[model samples]
Target chain A: AQSVAQPEDQVNVAEGNPLTVKCTYSVSGNPYLFWYVQYPNRGLQFLLKYITGDNLVKGSYGFEAEFNKSQTPFHLKKPSALVSDSALYFCAVREGSDNYGQNFVFGPGTRLSVLP
Target chain B: DARVTQTPRHKVTEMGQEVTMRCQPILGHNTVFWYRQTMMQGLELLAYFRNRAPLDDSGMPKDRFSAEMPDATLATLKIQPSEPRDSAVYFCASGTGHMNTEAFFGQGTRLTVV
Candidate 1:
C-alpha cells in the first residue's frame, strides 16, 4: 500500500520567516510527490511536484520542496512567509504499483498559519 | 486564465434527496478527476476520466454515486438519496495528460445534507 503522513496538524510561523511543512511517505517504488494549498472555501491549488529531477523543485507563490529519497520525505518550504500564506497544505503521492492504480494518496493535511 | 469550473458553489438539502454536481474542465485538457474533501479524509479521488472515457471510479460508492462525462467539456457526479455523511466539498480537477502532470482545480461545490 502507498501512504503519506504529515506529522504536524498545524504549523505557526512569523511573516518574513522561513516555513517548513513536513511530509513523509511509504511506497514500494519510486514516488511522485506533490504539494497543494487550499484556502478557506476554495479548491486546492497546485504548488509543486517532484517526479524525477533535482532534489529541490521550486513552485508558485515563492514555495519549494525538496525530495529526499533516502529519508522518504518531500517537505515543502518557503523562505519568507506572508500573512496571506495561511492555508491548508496537503502532500500527496502517486502510487507506483500497477495494481495500486493511478490515484493520489493525500496526507491528512497541515494547517499553516503565517503570523504578521 | 484557463481553469476548471464547478457549478453550485453551495448546496444545502434534506437527506434522501437527489444531488448533482457539475464540472467544466479546461479546454485542451484530456483528463478530469473528481474528489471529495473532509476534515477526516483530506481529499479522496472519487473518479477520473481520460479522453471522455471512465478510467477509474473505485473511490466512489457503487450504490448511490455515479460519474459521467457526457462530453469533453462537462462532467457530472450525481448522488441519489444522499445521506448526511455525503455533505462535503466536492472538487473537480483537470490535467493535460497523465498523473505525472499538474492538475488544476475548481473552486469546488459545498454540499450540505441535513
Candidate 2:
C-alpha cells in the first residue's frame, strides 16, 4: 500500500518570498512520487515527479521538489512566490512498477495562499 | 495536446435522481480512474479500469455507485439516489501502461445533489 500525507491544510506566503509545501509518503518496494497543482475551477496539472536519478526535480511554472529517501518526504518548493501561484497542491504516490492497479494514493491537499 | 475530457462540467439535480458523468481518456492510454474531491475528504479514488476491465472499485459505494468503461474511449460513472453528501467534483484520469507514468486529469464534473 502507498499513502501520502500533507501536514499543512493551508500555507500562506508573501509574494517574492520562498515557499515550501511539505509532503511525506509510505509505500512498499519503491515509490513514485508526484506533485500536482489545481487552480480555481480547474483540474490538477502535473508539476513534477521524482522517479529516479536526481533528488531535486524541476517542474512547470518554476516549481521544484526534492526527494528525500531517508526522511521519506518530497517537498515542493519555489524560489519566489507569486499571487497567481496560490492554489491547491496535492501530493501523490504509487507503489513501484513492481506493483500494479490504479492504486495512486493522494494526500489531503494543501491550499497555498500567496499574498501580494 | 492529448488530454482527458469530461462532460457535464456542472450538474445540479435533486436527491434520488440518477447522475451520470462521462470521461474520454487520452488516446493510447490503457488505464482510467475515477475520483471524487471535496473539502472534507480531499481526493478519494472511487474506481479504476485497465484495458476496459475493472480491476478495483472498493472505494466506491457498490449500492448506489457504479462505474463502467463501455469502450476504449468512453468511461462513465453512475450514481443513483444521490444525496447532498455526494455533491463534489468528480475527476477522471488516464495514463499509459507504465506504472511510473503520471495520470492526466479532466477538468472534472461538479455534481451538486440538492
Candidate 3:
C-alpha cells in the first residue's frame, strides 16, 4: 500500500520569507508523488508532481518540491512566501507497479498560515 | 481554461434523505474521479472511471454510495439514507490517463447532513 505522511498539522511562516512544508511517503516501488493546495470552501488545486524527474520539481505559484529517494521525503518549498500562499496543503502518492489505474493515497493535510 | 464543473454547490438535508451530486469533466479527458473531503479526513478517493467504465470503487461504501457515468459528459454520485457522518465536501476531478498529468478539480459540493 502507498501512503503519505505530513509531519506538521500547521506551518506558520512570515511573508517574504521562505517556507517549507514537509512530506514523506511509503511505497513498495518507485513513487509517484504530488502536492495540492486548497483554500476554504474550494476544491483542491494541483501544485506539482514528481514522477521520474531531476529531484527538484517546480510548480505553479512559485512552489516547488524535492523528491529524496533515500530519505523517502518530498518537501514543498517556496523561496519567498506571500500572504496569499496561506492555505491547506496535501501530499499524495500513487503506487508504482502493473496497476493501470492510479489510486492516490493522500496525507492528512497541512494548514499553512502566512503572517503579514 | 477548461475545467471540471460540479452542481449543487451546497446542500443541507435531514438524516435518511437521499442526495445526488453531478459533475462534468473537461473536454477530451477520459478519466473521472470522485472524492470526499472533511477536516478529519483530508481527501479520500471514493471512485474513479476510465473511458466511462468504473475502474476502482474500493474506497467507497457500497451500501449507500453509487457513482455512474451515464454519458461521456456527465458523472453522478448518489447517497441514499445519508447520515450526519456523511456531511462533507464532495469533489469531482478529471485527468488524462498519463501518470504525470495533473487532475483538474471542480469547486465541490458541500453537503451538510442533520
Q: Which candidate number has the best lDDT?
A: 2
TM-score of chain B of each: 0.97, 0.98, 0.98
Query: Whose DockQ is greatest here?
Result: 2
Ranking by TM-score: 2, 3, 1
Q: How many Å off is the CA of B1 in candidate 2? A: 1.9
- Model 2: per-residue Cα lDDT over B1-114, one tens digit each: 998999999999999999999999999998999999998899999998989998889999999999999999999999997999999999999998566789999999999999
Clashing pairs in 3: none
lDDT of 3 by residue, A1-116 (tens): 88899999999999999999999989988788889999888888999999885989999999999888888989999999999999999998877465454867789999999999
Chain B alone, candidate 1, TM-score of 0.97
RMSD of each: 2.0, 1.2, 1.3
Task: Please give, for residues A1-116, the per-residue lDDT of candidate 2 as tens digits.
Answer: 77898999999999999999999999876788999999999999999898889989999999999887788989999999999999999999977555354468999999999998
The predicted structure with the larger lDDT, 2 or 3, is: 2
Tens-digit per-residue lDDT, B11-78, candidate 1 = 99999999999999999988888999987877899998888888889999989999999999999999
Q: Model 1, DockQ value?
A: 0.52
Residue pairs with backbone atoms closer than 3 Å in model 1 (clashes): none
Shift of residue A32 alpha carbon in model 3, Å: 1.2
